[model samples]
Target: MFKSVLVANRGEIACRVFRTARRMGIRTIAVYSEADARALHVREADEAVLIGPAAARESYLDGAKVLAAAKATGAEAIHPGYGFLSENAEFAEAVTAAGLVWIGPPPAAIRAMGLKDAAKTLMIAAGVPVTPGYLGEDQSEATLTAEAARIGYPVLIKAVAGGGGKGMKRVDKPEDFAAGLASAQREGQSSFGDPRVLIERYITRPRHIEVQVFGDKHGTVVHLYERDCSLQRRHQKVIEEAPAPGMDAATRTAVTDAAIKAARAVNYEGAGTIEFIADASDGLKADRIWFMEMNTRLQVEHPVTEEVTGVDLVEWQFRVAAGEPMPLKQDEITLTGWAMEARLYAEDPANGFLPSIGKLEHFVMPDGIRVDTGVDQGGEVSQFYDPMIAKLIVHAETRQEAAEALAEAASHVQVWPVKTNAAFVMQCLEHPRFVAGDVDTGFIAAEGSDLAAEPLSEMGIEDAAHRLRHFAARSGDSADSPWHSLTGAVGFRANAPTRITQAVVVDGEAHVARMLDDDDHPMTRLIGLSVTRVIAFENGSAFDVSAFARGGSGAGNPASDGSLRAPMPGKIVATPAKAGDTVTKGQPIVVLEAMKMEHALVAPFDGVVGEVGVSVGDQVVDGAVLATVAVPDAR
Candidate 1:
């Protein structure tokens, strides 16, 4: 293997590669922009290089800068970890031209499958069934709408450039076609810098199944089974599992064959994935599967594939880049267990799953389960990158056991200050539909609110109250303590009937909590559930505090009040108003852009912007509002 390789990406993916490379005794280099100066990936890698400023266009997207970094670091090969330049055909070609090994598919393969429209055409030629839609080279809005009509109602308008659901829209009827097309084109242009689009027949009750394919310069290729990425939101995958459930032996063979066929059609090499949209209505029938696009690089959920096949795909990448042939033959590869991966994003599920940004205060990752994260506690989650905290992956003998493990793991994950979708992820893993193996692309959105519903026990409030009450009793009556008496000597004494009453808003309902704890009974009562564990933490100075978490039901943890904010880290594209500015409901306030996607922060109700803490182009995190609205008539 090569002595070293440079990962041309940031966040969890870069750190993930570094972990594998370090184990293989391969020195790894990380490239970071200004925003990622203190990012975990940079700190973890053996060597790091500064590429450019925060904007992806000037930094990670700059292929020449990456090549320069590789040369400067003496990196023998460059691994484009998933996003940034992973699927960029030109980047792969540039790396190869610079005499650096490209740890991905060949430039020809990338070019053939880079654009969805072109890839569909190639898949058709290769005899792999494709979704019947419009892949023609017509850019006009009228042309697209006409094509959608010809194709059928409920067509999906997808950006021909980027995948990750950046520029995708669904039209349920002909009347919604024009507006949806315009919006898709606008988002596509803003995100990918390409306004081109393709219309495809929307598979009702679609199941996203993709096969992992590996090849070498010797032209030898083999296929790894499939991953069911049916649990999705806004066209982006939220949860993925290996060896799709309910897939019979015949359909599995057919889908796997189709995936390999699509790969061989392009003469693919290195690690790539052929994604197919299967109509699950007929239970994964051979003829019901159609080609979706191919991912020309290592996938984010590659761990699930590894868990089942017991293969290290990154090692395979390194071997291939070093001019090695396929490591294992078709018959050698085997599925040993089931695996599931949940993308833990620093985004709020309650607030439409908007991106969240901030320092990870007391960030506690779930144990037992594998967590690949690029951020540590106190590291700033910048507004110039993806707000993905980590990928929580677990492997078990069976899918049910894996799901149970994943659910339990997510429940224990603690992200302080910044809101996360940890609880939301757990909810999905334990979702009955998911457990029963009856899920689809739209399952999450279809039943998301119910899944995110709050439990009635108010247990978390009771627990937090118990902990805070104990701290307040001995809390020195100093200026530092909010409840401290002015005398500066702890007003309340230890075990002296600590009387505390605080009201907190839970799910928009204000609830009052009264606690009384004395020497005889140090802990408070919850009517039925008893407080088993209490953790105390000391903040800056004399601000010592403790937290009580109730068991049995996860109802008492105090997290950021559910807020839809920035999803991934990015710059505030636009802030339209100042403090005290009255705005109507649905009025756009802050336009945040991350991963080249723009998300509009809208007003929840007709109210005045209370505070203008940030300005246009300001970098804000999740819940860090460019402007906050004043609740009407605060009585």
Candidate 2:
């Protein structure tokens, strides 16, 4: 085993790698950008080095800086944890040339599977089934349009170099193909420095099933079963489980055998994933599953696989990189009980799932389950990185047991100030179809509104009112006042109305609650940010309610005032409208890119664009005015 290793990444994955390295008595080195100087991973490392600025291109993605940091720290090996330089073939070769062990698949294997079109070609030659698509080298729009027509409507335009759903779009008709291809190519160039894309026939009912394959330097490969990542939003996996819920013995055998073949074709080393898209309109069939793409590094959902197989995948990576033989043969590795993982992100499901960046004033995870997190109380969720703050994994004797336990655990999460999708995830786990395992890639989008946080119940409102009164009575008032008498009577001015109503803000709207509070009431977790303000966690949702306050003077509602403002700090990626350009309601006015996602600020009503305050590539702060629309006067 290597005596010391450096993780060329940050956040939960970095911390995750360090944990395994520590257990094996290997010293862990962490590299960080200026933004992550005080990050959890940095604090946990045996030795830390500052690489560059907050921007990823200057820091995490800079291979030279990472190599220099490793050399300076005397790290014997470098583990490119998941993202950043993980799949960069040049970076892998650079590490080896620098006389440092690259704890990942060989550079050749990475290059083989790096591009989707090329990978599919290799797979087809190796007798591995691949999805039907156009992987031609032509970069012309005319060629792409013809290919889309050949594949029929609802073809998927995917960036040949894309992952994480960044450079992929689904076109339902010929008229939309040009715009979709342009969008995909633009994102591909921006993200991967490759403007090329491929056209694939869209599976109407696709279930994303990926097999975890590990290969050693001694030309030995084995499978660790499979994971079902069908619960997705915007093509990103939200929840994942091991040994797919509906997978049968025959289908499992076929898929696992094909995964091993795919690995052997590349002479793969270390850890990789062979993702397959299944046509599950009927049920999971071996012949219906086709190769989608290959992830040439450890995945974000590797924990679920680890739980089911009782294997230490990170340790396997280390061993394989050290030229060790396979830890166990394919026959020895067995799947035990089921495991489920839910990505807990710092995003508001109720607000278009927009990323929420702030200090975690009260961050707490539930007990009795595994929680892998990078941020703690008082840590900031910066806008420079992925918004995922934690991963909640649960394992049980059966699939249903695991799902129920995970749902219960998700409901107990208490994160405030910085909002999270804990409530949304809980709802997903508890949804009838989800619980019954009738799921596909379209699950989240199909049940979006139903999965959102429902309004606080009447009992919940009454509970909030009581808690407000309890907190208000405890502060500022004298001991001799009616508040200390333990009575339900509320203190008020002599000239006040007989039925006093206390105003409280929930989800930015004000609600009136008559003050008829009992001194003692059973309530959920509630924290007072101020005497007048308290955030209540009811049914796993955070409600920031302020007593006796009307409204906050932040950005004006665009529907009423025609002012489209930035909801958070982000770069203006596109301005689709300019001054005097007429646009209809809900037309995209400005597209703000933040936290690795695009949010469109749209026209609130049919009117002419009055002003476009920001230009493309301009970075604006929270609540900054981006654009406006004006109502035309009668002639």
Candidate 3:
């Protein structure tokens, strides 16, 4: 085994790799950008080095800086954890050229699978069933459209060099093919610096099933069963599970065998994943599955696979890098129990899943589960990186039990100030279609509005009212109390009949709450001053209600004035409306890019644009006003 290894990544994956390396008695080194100077991973490593500025292109993506840091720290190997430079073939070769062990697959294997079109060709030549698609080198739009026609309608235009659903689009008809192709190519160039694309047949009802494969320098390859990642939003996975809920013995064998064959085809070494898109319109079957793509590094959802197979994949990566043989053969590996993982992101489901960036004032993670997090209480979630806060993983003897545990765990999460998708995840776990194993890529689009709905129960509202009274009284007695009187009455007793009416806003809607007494309540166990967060449990699920004291009833509403604000900190990509432009309700005014996604700010009502505060290419912070519109006169 190598004596020391340097993790060439950041956030949770870096911390995860360090944990395994430390347990194996290997010294770990961490590299960080300017933004991550005080990050948790930096504190956890044996030695740390600052590479460059906060921007990824200046720091994380710079291979020379990473290699210099590794060499300066005397690291024997470098582990590229999942993202950044993990799948960069040139970086892998450079590391090897520097006489350092590259703790991943050989550069040749990475190059073979780096491009989707070429990889599909290789898979087909190796007898591995691949999805029918156009992998030609012709870059003309006319050629792609004609190929799409040949493939069939409802085809997919995917970036040959894309992942994470960045440069992908589904066109259901010829009328939309041109627009879809242009959009896909633009995103591809922006994200991957490659404008080339491939057309494939889109499965009507698809289930994303991927098999975890491991190979060693001695030419031994084995599979670690499979993970069902059908629960997705915007073509990105939200929840993943191992030993797919409906997978049978015959189907498992077929997929696993095909995965191993693909690995051997590339002479693959180290950890890699072979992802397959199964046509579940008729349920999972051996022949219905086809190769989609291969991830040439450790996956974000690898924890679920580890939980089920009782294998230390990272440790295996180290061993394989040291030229060791496979730890366990295919026959020896066993799937003992079911496991599920939910990715908790700092995003607002109510606001088109826009990324929420701010300090985590009160972050309370649940116990009795595996939580891989990058931030803690008082941690800053900046706009320079992915907004994933943590991953909640649970394992149980049965799939139902695992699902129930994961949902309950998601409810126990307590995040303040910044919004999260915790509630949305809980809803998916408890949804009838999800719980009954009837999930697909279209599940979120079919039932997302209902899942994202924030409906406060009657009891929850009452609990918030009670908690508000408690906080108000607590604040009144403080030395720095802002109010002159607690209840606006002198010598008022706790049991007095005087009632205080205060307006509380929950999820942007205001509600009138009455506080009669200060009697202690069970539901008000957890309360905060000024801002009271009430967590209520219903039917074995958790719901969070944040109640903030409103300014007043007659106060001028911001919405009425037509002030367009930046929802989160981002750069203005487009500002279509100018000053004095007559705009109708729901008209796009400003487009902001943050957390790797674009969001448009729309006019709230039919009105005339009065002033534009921001211009294109300018950066703005959260809640910053971008434009203003004059309120339309009442008809």
Assess each prediction's global lDDT (C-alpha) against the native. Answer: 0.76, 0.84, 0.82
Report the C-alpha lDDT of model 1 over 1-635, residue by residue, as the tens digit: 78999999998889888988999999989999998899899999898999999888889999999999999989998999998799888888899899888898888888889889999988888899999899888788788878888999899999898788888998999998886786688778877788899999998889999999888889888898999999988877889999899888999899888888888898888898989998988778888989899998999889999999999999898898898889999999998889999998877666667776766655667668788888987787766677777889999999999998887777656565567777777778877899999988989878877678243233433544445546556533344443322111111223212222222222222223333345333333222222222222111001112221322333345643213355554566557666667788777776676745667777777777776566656776544545567555631
Regions of model 3 farther than 4 Å from truth: 457-459, 462-464, 467-564, 572-591, 600-621, 624-635
- Model 1 scores a C-alpha lDDT of 0.76
Clashing pairs in 1: 355-566, 355-567, 356-622, 357-622, 383-569, 383-570, 385-569, 460-555, 460-556
Q: Give the candidates in order of TM-score, highest first.
A: 2, 3, 1
Please, what are the lDDT tens digits per residue for candidate 2 over residues 194-215? 9899999999999999999999
Scored against the true structure, residue 17 in model 1 reaches a CA lDDT of 89
- Runs in model 1 lying further than 4 Å from the true structure: 453-460, 463-592, 602-635
Best by TM-score: 2
Provide TM-scores for the models: 0.81, 0.89, 0.85
Which run of 10 residues does model 2 get worst, by summed lDDT?
Answer: 487-496
Clashes of 2: 0
1 or 3, which is superior by lDDT?
3
Q: Pull out the clashing pairs in model 3.
A: none
Score candidate 3 by TM-score against the native: 0.85
